[model samples]
Target: MSLDLTCPYCQQPFQLAGEQPGKHANCPHCGKQFPIPASEVRLSRKVDQEPVPQRIAPATFWYVQTEDGRQFGPVTEGQLQAWYEEGRITANCQLLRKGADQWQWATDLYPDLHQIGEKKPQGAAAAKPPPPKQALDRPALPQSAAPITPLSPDDFPTTGAGLKSLGPVLRPLPPGYGEPRLHSFEALEDRRKFAPFMVAHMNRPPLNKMLLVLGIANFVVGTLRAVLYFALFLGLLGAIGAVDERGDERVANRAAVSLGIAFVMFVLNIFVISGGVGLLQRKEWGRSATFAGTLIGMIIQLTCVCVTMMLGADGSGLASAIWIVLLVLLLPSILYDAFAAATLTLPSVVTDLEE
Candidate 1:
């Protein structure tokens, strides 16, 4: 490719082939080199900065693999159910979800979608004597399967970047001999369990996307926080005993009290960790534990900070540890807890978790 440039020294236009921005280039007319403007280099990036976020298509979302080799949809569970009932597809027909590699048999992907449909009114084909001739020995499909109720757009903002629009996109696959199926993470057997557990893996809360993310964050943060505080509790226990055996009795009592408080913090973090795990499993207790633990931890942490400040602290081990715990640890912990508690209460988030 060639780039158009005006020679800075000569004020003359010139074209340079095989040139990239940010390097010095000689002016053809004046024979003087000047640096290319890095300001306009949109593709340039700093290595220290985070990579841009990429969008992941919904996993449970699917496509109808037609016999004609032309696939249709970026369909949702509800849309797929509707298509099946209307006789547009069958249980044994091929279906390819957005993230799956091989086209899967409909019933294999969703056990509940077993070629059932609602019975037509009395003027249906069942009333007449069946014709003997048939092209395939396909079993008669049920008039209906259990109804699927997708989250209503009224309740959740479907247009958000994290979720596909309520209206399924019918865009055709791009022209290519080989595509998405190039990589398949799970084999047929592995998929058996994975299919059922996909919602948990998606790391997304019910229509309200924050719950899933919050759950994950809680799990990681809670785990690290628990380990940190628990270790401190054990160390404090050793110190409390040693100080009582050798140091001042008054300082020993203070150390014992600190040990008790450390124990409380450790237990609270454990509940926080448990809550995160629970949410991942879609259990109501998980959400409850996470929120309750966060709130209580925040209250205790704030009280400790206020009391420690009001009653001037000394240059002792317990006081220094309290300063670190209060300013370095609890401040962020309190902020995260506040956010998590509020997120848990979102109407959509609560409904999704409860359901």
Candidate 2:
């Protein structure tokens, strides 16, 4: 015959063969070991009627007190048992179940808790026999000797004779030994004032690193543009020479003017690239120079936009559209410059530069 069993820990119902009462079994679902209750046996009945399954209510929660006078929980009996088995709660610890009036020692309340995982010993060896006590009889001493008295500080001499007998006297420790050193209030107050700024400075490194990458990229692109412009200037010089040979003075003069403009552009590119390098090094002057250059570039861009609009009004559709696209592309750079300008002026950055 099979018996229906409910796991006390997990409340999972399972079938068990007819077995001894109070036998321990492991729950298949949660793998927790629990004793089978005596009331959990299947009863024989008529085959025509369906058997009504018995419902098991949840276990009452118990509270345990620590050795340090701290009380913890409303934990389940399973949890408390686990704690007991794990040695977290000792046998001497006090526990009180829900609706209980008084607290009691865990070992006194649950005597078999410590034997949960221990195997019962078999045979005569299981019953430990008490050791027999041996007599400690001895002859009494004679009464003539006086009893020894405990020594007191007054028994020792405290004068020059005692010092001479004891050898050289030890010197006292130098001044300030074991003394608590005083700190400056002003210094502590200063640290308190700059605590937030110090945090900001520590967090500033990531933004600074990003700015350095941008600076390097700007320098590299400017250098490449300068190289291209120089090549173009050489080509223009050749073209101007050819125009002069053909006796077209106006065209040659225009070519020379174009070459001059390219040379100026090359110089500006060199300055801009150098500024980018300085900015990467976080130089204060570099920030100022870059800010001035960006402001000038934005002004020039606005002027170009105005010119493009004027030309568009005269039916230059392609140029207007191209200029508008360029303006849209520059928006990110404009915002970045604005952010950089604001960040550079922060108190933390200023303090870092000073340092």
Candidate 3:
């Protein structure tokens, strides 16, 4: 009689000799090894019987702490092994398995994760020095060994007799030898507060200096213009006074209007000069004022350019060419204003200023 058996891996059925019952044999259909069932057991099972399910345990995960006191979590064991092999994690790193209450040193917890170097064959040659013992391999000192005692001033030698009487003293090592060094996060945060300002000051960009120079130049030009306007106003006042009683009313009215315009321009120029000085000093308000002036200047330039373009459309070719040339000449000032605005608005500069 032949005995029937099912392969666990492939679930294929095959037959063996009755004498081969309870013996391992390769399945004919799947070529897999399986134990031959006894004749009595084989007769009890039907050909349509369902395969039994195998129970397997779920995968385990671990958490790790970095040298910087950062906690990385729920990582698989394989990933930890990869990190260890890649040098991202060190032997001194702490790891805790999922659901574990305490952490352990990685090397002590998973010794098999790292490979041991091959041992040299014993021969008639000089023997190599023994490998240094790992921290894990060090045996704990017995309780009977000397207990830790408080240190006294006598521990230090001030005189020759004190030094001679002091013998070798064994002290207990401090706790958490493999732990990461402690660092104060608060100190780091405090330094960060001023870091941006210090960096900005140390490496002041060329653009900022250019903006300052532009501001100073603007102030000087405004000062000269103000002086010229003031002189013109005084001259206009004297001319009005010298006008004959019988002089034309139209001429007198024109002089008064011109004087008023000059006075207004002088006052406006004073404000412009002040704004320029503020810009040179890197004041926040100075930046705002300078930006406002730049906008006004740009608007006036655009309006003039548009009017010239329209008027020159029907004028001589030379007139049109002149208008184009004027526009081109004004482009640099407009671009400089834009550059200054952008430089002042930079985050580093903004952070350096008071609110």
lDDT of each: 0.65, 0.57, 0.57
lDDT of 2 by residue, 1-355 (tens): 5667788878889877666567887788899988876665423223324767766665566677654545666665555544554455654456666565556665565454333223323325334222111212223223323332322334322243313221222334445467676768987677667795665555555435545765775587557757966996998989988998899887777678758866765665565577677777666666565555455544543554566567663344345565577567556545544554465566654443311
* Candidate 2 or 1, higher lDDT: 1
lDDT string for model 1 (1-355, tens) is: 4566788788999877654777988998889999877543332333225577877544356666554444566655655554654656644356655554455565564454332332222345554323122112334444446553433435333243444322332334445535556435556446656674574446544444576787789889888888888888888888887887786888787777778888888888889888988887677898889989998988987887777766655744346665665677678888998899898887777675643
Clashes of each: 6, 0, 0
Whole-model lDDT, model 2: 0.57
**Candidate 3: stretches off by over 4 Å:** 1-183, 188-207, 244-247, 291-355
lDDT of 3 by residue, 1-355 (tens): 5555677788776666645657678877777676665764556454336577766456566667654445665655555544554455554456666555555665565453322222223333243222122212223232333332322344322244322211222234345446666658976667667695774566554435555675786687568767977997999899788764668676678678768866875665576577688766666676676666555655554665666677574442235665677678657655654665566667755443432
Q: For each candidate, what TM-score against the reference?
A: 0.41, 0.33, 0.33
Clashing pairs in 1: 116-144, 117-142, 117-143, 117-144, 118-143, 118-144
What's the lDDT for residue 256 in model 2? Answer: 82
**What is every candidate's alpha-carbon RMSD to the true fold?**
32.7, 25.9, 21.9
Ranking by lDDT: 1, 3, 2
